[model samples]
Target: MRKTCLDMVYELAKADDRIVFIGSDLGAGTLSEMQKNMPERFFMEGVSEANIIGMAAGLAMDGFIPYVNTISTFITRRCYEQIAIDLCLHNLPVKLIANGGGLVYAPLGPTHLAIEDIAIMRSLPNMNIVSPSDAEEMKRFMNQSKEIKGPVYIRLAKGGDEIVSDPKNGFKFGESILIKDVGEVLIVSSGITTKEAIYASEELSKEGIKAGVLHMHTIKPFDYKSIIKYSQKVKLIVSVEEHIKNNGLGSAIGDVLNDNCYHKMPKLIKLGIPDQFPDKYGTQEDLLKYYSLDSKSIYESVLGFIKSKGLKAA
Candidate 1:
């Protein structure tokens, strides 16, 4: 997904003169072709993440849309003030390509894990958050990103994920894609977790349970209308995400349900990392399993929730 995003940036730059690429201590060959062809527009800065945010803001102010690349933790946690003041405050057309979002950097421990990136970025007023499910979705999102009017936080997962998205369904920023039709239960997810949600839905189907999958690639400017429309048809709503349960995708859905579906709110179960930092270090899959965010665990959780609520299959 990261490779597809940067490749699209290079492709976008080739067509638009106003597009610029900015990297903070990335690989020498990150965008070798773009750097070789457009040296003037491509910039590879040092380890200063905050400085790069300011630079991107300046470039955006000068009518150039800058695409900044860096680790998710560094770009967000290390430069919160700069992102809030420089990029989001002015609502610039800067795309923040955050690599290794969520627990992708789990081997490096809690400091490198971007478990709170979504919550952090969502707090900023003008910042938009997008977590594509896979490379295909990333391509679709990047192809249309230029039209968005403000700073965008493009959350990326580890590459080589399952291609669960269908082109026929279409792609639109700030809109939720209904991967499966409405059923007795709905699984709402973003980023790589959407794949797990799909798997869980299939597993539930095998047991005479009816479950649907709703992929919310764009977190901010969330598809509230879809949530309201779907929630009315389901007995339970399960929200799964890679980030923390607080103020992440689950929280966003909760807020929407509270404001719009007060009287007829469905039972919601938020599956994500807890508020506390992880104590062990391992692969992304290991952490996900530990937190019960894996496909099997998600299936079990949803099954348990349904049994507890006495929701019958349709």
Candidate 2:
């Protein structure tokens, strides 16, 4: 996903003269072809993440769309003030490509984990957040970022994820895609967790419960319309994400449910990291399973949730 996202930046720069690329202490040969082609527009800065936001803001003021790439923690947690003041305050058109979102860098420990990134960024006005399921969807997000008026943060997962998103359907920044809507059990998910939701749908089908999957790739301008549609159709609604349960995708959906669904509203089972630092080092997949985010765990959790409500299985 990282390569695809950056390559699209390089690709976008080829066409639009106003497009520029800025890196915060990235490695050598990172977008070398882009630098070779458009050296003036490419900037490989050192470890100063906060300074880069001010610089990107300045460039944005100059009518150039800057794409800033760096580790998620450094760019967000470390540079929150600059992001809020420089870019977000002015509503600059800077695309922040945040790498290692969630526990992608689990081996690096808590300092690198971006578990609460969404919650923090969401608080800032004019800041838009998006998490694409895989590389294919990342391409779509990058393509649309050009038109976004304010600062947009694109959360990127580790590359080589399952291609659950179909390119034929394409991708819109603020729209939610409903992969399937069959039974009363609706599984709402975003980012790589959407892959698990897709799998859970199939597994639940065998159990006489035809679960549906609603993929919310864009989180900030959330598709409450889709959530409303499913809220009315399903008896049980389950939301999943790679971030913490609070102030993430689940919380956003919860707000929508509270405001819109009163009578006959489906029970919600929100699954995610339990708002604590990981206890051990492991791969991303291992960490997700440790948090009960694996497909089998999610399937079992949803089934248990359904039964807890005294709802009979189909």
lDDT of 1 by residue, 242-295 (tens): 988999999999999999999899989999999899998889999999999999
Per-model C-alpha lDDT, please?
A: 0.92, 0.89
Root-mean-square deviation (CA) per prediction: 0.9, 1.1
Residues 1-314 of candidate 2: C-alpha lDDT, one tens digit per residue: 99999999999999999999999888678999999989999999989998999999999999999999999989889989999999988999999999999989999999999999998998899999999999999988888889999999999998788788998778989998888774878988889999999898889888878788988999887799999888898888888888888898989989999999887578888989997887888899999898888788889987887777777767
Candidate 1: which stretches are off by over 4 Å?
none
- Model 1 TM-score (2 dp): 0.98
Instruction: Determine the C-alpha RMSD for candidate 1 after optimal superposition of all C-alphas.
Output: 0.9
* lDDT minimum window of 10 residues, candidate 2: 305-314
